[model samples]
Structure formats: C-alpha cells, structure tokens
Target: MKIQLASSEADIERCYPIVARWREIEKRSQFVRQIQEQQKFGYYFVYLEDDRIEAIAGFHIIQTLARGRVLYLDDWIGETSEYTSGYSRILFDWLMDYAREHSCQSLRLNSSVRNIQAHQFYFKNKMKIEAFQFSISV
Candidate 1:
C-alpha cells in the first residue's frame, strides 16, 4: 500500500462513503472544506492498494497550550473488511515517520467514546489515553 496526499475530488470521493458513516455518527462533516482548508499547512493522507483506497488519515500541525507543537490526528477510517488487517498500522507508521521528519513533538487524536474497537487498536499500538475529552453543546 502507498500513502498519498488526497487533494483531488476523486481522492475525496474515495473516502466519502466510509467517512460519511462516521459523520452521521458524529453529526458533523469532520473533514469538510474547513478541515481541508487547514490541510494547506499540514497533511491529509489516503492509503491506496491496487488502485483502490484502503484508508484515510488526516493530521494538522498545531500548537496547543497543553501539547505545544504536535501532529493532531483529526480523523482515520479504514474499510470494514480491512480493519485490523495491518493497514491501520501501516498508515500510522507512515504518519509517525512523517512526523519525525517534520520534528513534531507528538501525535494526538480524540477518539469518540462509541468507538471501542478503535480505542483497543490505539492501545495495542502503544498509544496512551492521556485524558478524557469532555464537551458541551450550546
């Protein structure tokens, strides 16, 4: 599999169906134009194998009061059939290498509470749950 920057409409289309499912659950277009606009300063990667999209991962380089300069992973989704098939690891490993090359302090992500399997994957991958994310809707 190869990781490539998803800049074209076709690339985004490849991710739309899978990401739309997540957007329905989350009640927002997590990777819409606003987020894509932010990609100008960061990275938006899609995994491809045999001319088909396997997964998508987006990250942004940002400075936060707590984490400072870090690569914040905004979203990741793999085909259900490909889940736990090592594609996720490959994508993450590529992101890690990318981060290292750019001198990022850390990689951060916010996983929704509903995504239990994803949490387990993160744990298995040696990622720690550093904090609980709380939110209030106005």
Candidate 2:
C-alpha cells in the first residue's frame, strides 16, 4: 500500500475514474484541467495498492482568522462499498500525519448536512462539529 500526491499528469489522470464516481465531473479532460488549475494551491493524494488507486483526497492549506493554518480537505472518496473499512482509515491517517508534518493547527473537511453516514464517520474519527455552514445556491 502506498499514498502519494498525484503530481504527474499520468498520476492525476489515473485518479479521474474514482473521482468521477463521487463527483459530478462531466469529462476527464475537464477534471484534468480543473486539477491543474487548482494545483497552484491544492493537491490530490491517491491511495494505491498493487499500483491500483483505491482512494483519493484533495486538499489545500489555508490560513483563516478562526482556524489559523488549517489543512482543509476538499474531496475524499474510496471504493464505494469499502470506504467504511480500514482503507479509509489508512488514507485518513495519512492526511492527518501530513497536517501535523506541515504544522497545521487543524485538519478539517465539510460533509453535506444530509450525509449522515459521512458525519458518523467523522464523529468516529473524533472530529467535532465546530460550526454551521450556511450557504445559498446562486
């Protein structure tokens, strides 16, 4: 098992299918292009076993008046059925380790209010609900 940042185009492209499964990306090209643009401040991390990608995490470091320097996770998905298994733990642990290594004050991610399962997982991981995020679609 290995976790790595998808820095090369080939590695990033290899993550497209898994990402598309959980995201509404319309095309692989669009995914690549958008990833490229975001790479200026963010990163895509892939979890691999036997060279097959099993999970992906997209994150960026940010400084906020409330949180200070935070490792903000933007996207996360793993094999649909197996996401609740240890594989997710490995990936999540990796992300946490990374945050500590970078001297981040916290690691955070937002799950939709309707995603009870994800919320449960976050709770299981010992993450607290710090605030309510209110948004209106424009």
Candidate 3:
C-alpha cells in the first residue's frame, strides 16, 4: 500500500471517480475543480494498493473562531472491502501526521446523519462527537 498527497491534474483525475462514487448525493464538477485549484489549502490523499486506487481522503487546515487552527476532514472513502479493515486507520494516521506537521490544534469532521456506520467508525477511532451541525439550503 502507498499513500501520497495528490499534486497534479492526473491526481485530480484519480480522485474524481472516488468522489463521484462515494458522494453520489450530489454532482458538482465545478466544485471539484475549485477544490483542485485550492490544493495548497489542503490535499487529496490517495491510497494505492497493487497499483489500484483503493481510497481517497480529503483534508484541510482551517482557522475557526471556536476551534482555532484545526484539521477538517472533508471526505473519506475507501473501497467497501477496506472499511473496518485498517485502511481507514492508515489514512487517518497519515492525515494526523500531516496536521501535526502544520501545527493544527485538532481534527474534525461532520459525518452525515444518515451515515450510521461512519459514526461508529469515528467513535471507534476515538473521535469525540463535538456538536450538532445545522445547514439551511440557500
């Protein structure tokens, strides 16, 4: 297995399919392109095994009034076979290391309310349920 921060147009291509697969709830090519343009703000890390892309994790360092400097995980998805099988841990550890290197104070993510399995996974990983996130569609 190999993990590396995606850094090129090709890398963005590698990430698109994974994002599309996991986030079929929405489709926004322009948003994806915006994310690609802002690679300096965060990274799309790809996990490759046997020359196949198995997972992708997107993370960013953000400054918040409440959280201060923190690492915000935007999206994380692994092939179903890889879930609960240590691949998530590996990807998280890598993100944590990257956060630490950048002096981030904490790591946070908003798991969709419907993703019960993801909530369990986060709990198992020792992440605390911090607060409720509310959104209103504009």
Please list the C-alpha lDDT of all candidates, in the order they appear: 0.74, 0.83, 0.74
Please provide TM-scores, in order, for all candidate models, with all chains considered together. 0.80, 0.91, 0.83
Clashing pairs in 2: none
Candidate 1: where is the Cα deviation over 4 Å? 25-45
Where does the lowest 10-residue lDDT sum fall in candidate 2? Answer: 42-51
Ranking by lDDT: 2, 3, 1
Give RMSD to native, each candidate.
Answer: 3.4, 1.6, 2.7
Number of colliding residue pairs in each model: 0, 0, 0
Off by over 4 Å in 2: none
lDDT by residue for model 1 (23-83), tens = 6634235545544666666666555544566777877788778877788888788866445
Over 12-96, each residue of candidate 3 has an lDDT whose tens digit, in order, gives: 5666665677665254565467666667555555544436677787777789898899988887888765558677778888888
List, residue by residue over 33-120, the lDDT tens digit for candidate 2: 8888889756655545545778888899988998899999998888765447677888889999999999999999888888888788
Candidate 3 accuracy as lDDT:
0.74
